[model samples]
Target: MNFAKGLILCGAIVAASANAQLRFEISGVGSTQIPVAVASFADEAIAPAIVSNVIKADLERSGVFKVIDAGRVISETSAVDYNEWKARGARALVVGSVSKLADGRYDVRYKLLDAVNSGELSSMGQSTAARYTRLAAHKIADDIYEKLTGVRGAFATRIAYVNENRANRLYKLEVADADGEGTQVAVTSNEPIISPSWSPDGTKVAYVSFEQKKPIIYVQDLVTGGRRVVVNQKGNNSAPAWSPDGSKLAVALSRDNHTQIYVVNADGSGLRRVSNSAGIDTEPQFSSDGQYIYFTSDRSGGPQIYRMPATGGNATRVTFNGNYNTSPRVSSDGKTLAWVSLRNGDYGLYAMDLATGQELRLADNATEPSFSPNGKYIMYATEAGRRKTLAVVSVDGRVKQRLTTNAGTIREPNWGPFMK
Candidate 1:
């Protein structure tokens, strides 16, 4: 009856936290990510100092603000002497206190101060269950990110992925809040679901399901629990990638004898070819602008990334580093390309600047990286021992964190677009 059951019969798997008036009033994107100093919260009787570290990690990972390293601090105090923080080149300071609520909850408060002028900029507070203390810290960071960047921080968005239990031969799809809460099954099956991709609008997901014993692509609406077959043609109907506008889907189908990239209507019409390489081509993704289609092809001698016009053009090779590169995804802004690279005898997430052709390594042995809509973060699946879990990291390759529940082997994570 639920979406999760649909996936199991076919094969796959699949909240919002409480409403808080998350008021964000950030100043303009200052000339730079203002340098800020955060003192470690004392009195574990109040809140754990570990929360301070989490907050620091979130701010630093944003690539927006420069946080003063507490490792350099020589004193622990409640009142910040502005000159000390200013001497460390910090323009802002955050001071906070935490207290226990009778309900076994935590009341956390933080105040942002302009170290430059020694004035209060903004203050925010949050309450959370004791187990969610780390999330409380991330919420503080989200408030700061929204205030500064004018975009909501994804610190609270969940990543959905598939997990496999080989012994039982079961596969499960699961979801958890951004801070790793309320993890529940999206779907599960004896078969497998691969390449789960969120539609640009964030209301539905298109994925490859093996419920009928052959790989077929289906689009499932998150709200109505309704699904439509997107592609079920012969010979490997895998890799369903949605276009930026959600008007079309790019997929790899071998119906014509060779696996190649094809574009079709998201509603399952207007099928067309985007790549026609003599060799196998799969994993077709659209550039952020939707002007170009990028895919993996052995047409370049081995699996490598190539780009062509969305309307079809001479394919141009984009990756030159590794002997094999596949599953290329362009960021929302079309500025960076992230893909799995088989280099150094391992598969990891490698990013390349679309304009400069410079590569930045983001993760190790990761697959199916779905970029957040804001283009600031990436969620991908990786193996820890035999189990796969979803790992999220900033675009700059810093601040890596894992989101997992009791369900084992999470794979093929797709971060949905920003949804209210």
Candidate 2:
């Protein structure tokens, strides 16, 4: 990872390796992981949802917890066998149960315990619709993770991606659970759909559609299933990125000059070009505070990352290490930057601490990187053995996992924010 091949302008769907059904192929290990046990929910075998299973899967996928004793029946009220779990090297234990309510809803309950101290750490229960059982399980996992790891879990969030069906020439914009389950199609067309960006509130998504033989930006409401054209100019209106406050979208438009960055109101008003560079500038991502825009440009000889005031003037180079760097993604805290840098001969994912300038390579052959709400992980599309797949890596580059499907190629993954 020391040299560059060439400048790749378009971020297309790179073929990946996986099955028709989406599954997680996790690899690598963290420097440290908490040892815990997630027991089977008492009487959950009689319910339609296996609460404990979902909780265990979410915790394990995070690479923060090593789950054991998942088949043993346990409930929040059950007596804790501290000696047994402590002998098994368990630092913490989780117990939960799901039961039908008289109102036809379901109640999911869970509790976290300290195996060493033999005391309850936390407990929570939620009454939700029958269909939200999986969501509840994810919520429970989030709680357990926060209690044990001191970091909020992203399991309750969602992901938006483009699923390509090349055989039918069809493209679908879909949103699914964090674990790649419960997919719901938001938009579909025979033409190509690229660069899906989620609104900050998680209620809408803006993307580029080539429906009319050209790229047009459109924003769709996930709740209402209604979409409206946000930017349908004479030229290309692609790479729509939302402001941190969800009031505006910074996009790369070819309407004025050579694909300069522009900021427009979320409702398609007040369109104004922001970049004044002679070379092409695109992929405008807003800083966490919505103060500046991070974009790629060829202004200084080779494609490199730069930033400028969100409203307009004074561009400054941000990526000086690479001759070819693109897709600058600032973490939610505005402390780190993630980008795809050409290294050796392949495009790879890299993260840099803006404060310390310490850079770490997250993955090789990765692109379209998006950060999770908690800033703990970065999800990006990458080529895994010639297949189109989506993978996530911890900011420290310690934990890595791939989400792939044999059903079709899924790319342009945008990890959504946590809902209110």
Estimated TM-score per prediction? 0.74, 0.93
lDDT of every predicted structure (CA atoms): 0.72, 0.85
The digit string of per-residue lDDT tens for model 1 on 240-316 reads: 88888899999889999999889999999999887776898888888888888998888867788889998887999
Q: Model 2, which residues run further than 4 Å from truth?
A: 1-21
**Taking the tens digit of each residue's C-alpha lDDT, what string does model 2 give over 259-284?**
89999999999999889978889889
- As a whole number from 0 to 100, the lDDT of residue 140 in candidate 1 is 75
Instruction: Give the top-scoring candidate (TM-score).
Output: 2
lDDT, residue 293, model 2 = 95
lDDT over C-alpha atoms for residue 190 of model 2: 84
| Residue 44 lDDT in candidate 1 | 38
